[model samples]
Target: MDEWVERALARFPNVPALFGWLGLDRRGHWLIQGERISHARIVETIARNYGVDDHGRWFFQNGPQRGYIALEYTPLIASVQADDTLMAHTGRAIESVSALYLDEDSTAVLDTPDGAALVQGADLAWVLDRLRADDSDKEIDDQALSNALAVPSGTQTDLTLVVGNDRLPVYRCDRADIPATLGFVQAPEPRDGENSN
Candidate 1:
């Protein structure tokens, strides 16, 4: 949240919160009225102010008014920057790089920060770049990578991939338990038929 935006809330305390009008799509793009917001400045501004309420709803604080967002997937969306660094959409360093799972859309869901969030497909190479198995950190091979993706069914089994200086776990999450496993709401509906926008 921005400081100037906080002051605006105090100045005009009666502004109502908008519901289901704003949205954050899978690729970390902002959407308004079912269309992607084209202006970079406006999109960045809203992303900067994005936050979750007590009821587990994500919203953008537009000056004093709260514009609730309907999320197509998880709240956090990110990609690997040009420098090969993984970053969260909120512009934070994705820390602890714990676990990875492939979603139904074939997108990577990284378990870090707030619950699990989608990782851009192109950035996935970095996650797979240094992966190694067996008793040692041997250089990645074609067969090993293939075996990693096809883990035995009904198990927590996954391959250990090197992330930064640490070996992180990666696997394919079952489609049915995605929401339960990741601990995030895939689709959020407006509460109590409310529309503050």
Candidate 2:
């Protein structure tokens, strides 16, 4: 959260929190009443003020009002930069990465510094470039990736990726458990709070 936004909240301590009116789509675009939010400044403000509550619900603390955001896929999106680096859609530079998983739907999820965010498919090549055979640093192909997932034994070989100045290993996780593993609620319900303004 931005310090100014925090100050605004402190200034107007009785503003109401809005819900069901704001949303965050799969591509990281902000939406209002089912329409796309094209205003760059508003989007930037929302992004800058975005945060989560103690209940693990994501929201944009807009100046004095808290607008709970309903996410389409994930609360955040990790985009590939022109320099092959990764950044959150909210404009946060990815300093450290914990895990990465490619689902059957070709959706790549990343546990980055911001949070667990979905990586745009078009930018998956950066992740693929780092995946190598378990025993070697040689690159892996589609079939090889499948084989890594289809081991007959209990243990399976995972992949690896390098982020910033660290070499991190990627793990394969069922997409069904993403919310649990990442500790984020995809479909956050309404909360009970004082209706003030």
Query: What TM-score fits each model?
Result: 0.79, 0.86
How well is each residue in 1-197 modelled by candidate 1, as lDDT tens digits? 88989999999987867766788887888889789997988977887898876666678899999887777777888788788777888787676667777544445677875656777767777666666665467666777666655664224434676777877676766655666676655545556755454
Candidate 1 has what TM-score?
0.79
- Prediction RMSDs, each to the true structure: 3.1, 3.0
Off by over 4 Å in 1: 11-14, 104-106, 139-155, 191-197
Task: Give lDDT tens digits, candidate 2, residues 1-197.
Answer: 78888899889988877877888888889999889999999999888889887776798888888888888877889888988777899998877788676554556788866678898878878777877766566888898788655643223256666666556665555667667667787766665665732
State the TM-score for model 2: 0.86
RMSD of 1: 3.1
- Superposed by TM-score, candidate 1 places the C-alpha of residue 177 at a distance from the truth, in angstroms, of 3.3
